[model samples]
Target chain A: GEEVAQTPKHLVRGEGQKAKLYCAPIKGHSYVFWYQQVLKNEFKFLISFQNENVFDETGMPKERFSAKCLPNSPCSLEIQATKLEDSAVYFCASSPPHFVAKNIQYFGAGTRLSVL
Target chain B: SQQGEEDPQALSIQEGENATMNCSYKTSINNLQWYRQNSGRGLVHLILIRSNEREKHSGRLRVTLDTSKKSSSLLITASRAADTASYFCATDISGNTPLVFGKGTRLSVIA
Candidate 1:
């Protein structure tokens, strides 16, 4: 695939319930990143992966948020015990190897999560 | 945390008019890139300017980066109604890290 693909265009979860989102990065892309956007404002980086290894997790909340990228499978982000503050659009992006000259990232349509 | 802040927050212009947006960052960067997002859509890459490059042009879009001031500006020439979207400036600090995005500028091109 030439573009990143995200599953469940919209997801609704009750407070304290678990929510999961999925993303399939572009074919051959080695870097995958997740970001959260609230109120259509600035994007908050959640996590990033280089191939199947975690490249950066500093922006992720360790308590209830977890993510994984395994070979031959789409990456996943799961939130346990969702809160109202967790309501936002989750975007997944993929970029080619960092060694490439440009650092451009291709984004998915995003999953809009609503915590009731 | 966001490192870039966009100016004006929002803007409106008649079709065919040029629109410009500014962004300022708090730290040095390896490159600055612009992205456009239509309502409820994925972001579209606009242009990217390296730290050493001062300006770049692609079709109707022009990007200028001033490393000394840690600021960048995007200009859209002859805007169209379909061009109405939020514009964001993202900075790559080390080229390998995730980009830090700004709040973004909402531009409405009225037909």
Candidate 2:
């Protein structure tokens, strides 16, 4: 695909329920990133992968947030025991190899998560 | 924590006027890129400027970077109502690291 794809345009989950989101990077892109936007404001970087390998996890919350990218499958971000504050838009982005394209990312339409 | 902060949280302009937004970062960056988001949609990449480069232009968009001041500005010339959107500035501290985005500036182009 030419654009990064994200599933579940809107996810409504009860508080404390588990929530999962999926992202498929653009074809031929090696880097995938996840970001969380709250109140349509600042984007908080969550995690990143390079070809199914974890490139950076510094932004992830180790307690209940986990993510994975496996070969032949779309990457996944799962939040366990979701809280009211967890409601926001989750965006997925993909970029070509840094050496080749200088880290310009292409974004998906994003999934709006609502925890009530 | 966010690395960049955009000034003028919101702006209103009549169509056909120019709109300018400013961004200031706290640390050195390898490159700075601007993105626009329309209402509930995802962000669209606008333009990118490298650390060593001072300015760049693409169509109706112009970007300027000053590493010494750790600031950048985006100019939208002859804007239209379709140009109304929230603009963000993201910084790439390292070539391979995730980009750190600013809070964004919301611009409303009234017709």
Candidate 3:
């Protein structure tokens, strides 16, 4: 069994401020992902990384959001300017197989971000 | 685009009753996975069925996949109140694409 650990269970930020979230994947996993859940809606993918390199960032909002996975370190998602719409629970996931979408992913408890 | 759509947005059943949820997808997939979310907690993987497989079972959960119809169903037998949660179906298509999740089915198990 494996786990993805996320820090800062909850966060509160004023509008226009920045918010940063962290995710530590299972030791052997190579693929990491970030998602946003707004209420009961389905999770929306934000970005994915393979080790320290980003694999896909198509779902990211380039003007304000960025994510990186530093060597030997967990991944991080940073939103430079927060907005009312940014209030949601953020999830992190990891998969052991780097290039296979079929690989089952493990998820973290997530960071609940509230933007005022 | 999200590939899966779950039907019967909500369900309420008594204990000992079997609860079933259906899901339909728009595209071909490498595999389909079912997950359960207990309120604000993270999603817990329930079962995964590959495109080549027809039926799979784990504990009290049974999953049936029909590639021809591009649909799947998850059945929970002898459900309990602890099983009350939001269940979602996700699709892993193209081998490398990120999993796209459906809106989910909210099931409430009454004692």
Candidate 4:
């Protein structure tokens, strides 16, 4: 697909277990974003990366959620000590070097996480 | 939270009719974008209207942004059954800011 590729279409984890999801951005894209969608509701921004550097992580919950987009590696979002509230669809998106006019982002199919 | 709030959380319309969804936000935005999500799929960008622009169109989809009122609207003309999906509006305050999305409107286009 020409779109972002997300791994583990669906994930199941215990309350205290760890869950990690990976995303591969489209070729040549320099920006990556992570969002969490609950049911069919609004999207919550978790973090963003500009190539290998963290762009904005103010939305990240400082305690358990962490994400990285390292060189030669797929972007990954990890949830440590997952809770029931962590259950949701995690979406990954990517965009070319954003210049306002080229700010359109493409999204992945998302990884549905079920924390029991 | 600077998240946008969409009006008429749900809309039901017959095919061939026009459907409109509105979104209001609390902060100044660089641009407002509309996206569509079908069932459990990821959101696909529909249209984007910059803060300095009023309207834009792509096929049967039209998007209007009113920066003064901090609101925007997405209109799907001559809607089809395939247009049934959840529509969301996302806003960004700056080029580098992360987008804050609206709660979305579940639009049902009945055949």
Task: Give fnat, all candidates.
Answer: 0.84, 0.80, 0.64, 0.64
lDDT of 4 by residue, A1-116 (tens): 47899999999999999999999999888899999988769688999999999999988999999999999899999999999999999999998887634578899999999999
User: Which residue segments of model 4 deviate by more than 4 Å?
Assistant: none
The per-residue C-alpha lDDT of model 4 at residue A64 equals 92
Tens-digit lDDT string for candidate 4 (B1-111): 547899889999999999999999998888889999999899898888889999999999989888888889899999999999999999887775688999999999999
Q: How close is candidate 4 to the true structure, as a TM-score?
A: 0.97
Tens digit of lDDT per residue, candidate 1, span B36-72? Answer: 9999988889999999999999999999999999999
Tell me the tens digit of each residue's lDDT in model 1 across A1-116.
98899999999999999999999999989999999999998799999999999999999997999999999999999999999999999999999987874789999999999999
TM-score of each: 0.98, 0.98, 0.95, 0.97
Binned by DockQ into CAPRI classes (incorrect, acceptable, medium, high), candidate 1 is high
Report, for every candidate in turn, its global Cα lDDT versus the true structure: 0.95, 0.94, 0.90, 0.90
Error of 3 at A101 (Å): 9.5
lDDT of 3 at B92: 83
TM value for model 1: 0.98
lDDT of 2 by residue, A1-116 (tens): 98888988999999999999999999999999999999999799999999999999999987889999999999999999999999999999999988888889999999999999
Instruction: For residues B16-87, write the lDDT of model 2, one tens digit per residue.
Output: 999999999999999999999999999999999999999999999999999999999999999999999999
CA shift of A72, model 3, Å: 2.2
Q: After superposition, how far is residue B18 of candidate 1 from its true place, in Å?
A: 0.5
Candidate 3: segments with Cα more than 4 A from true spot: A98-101
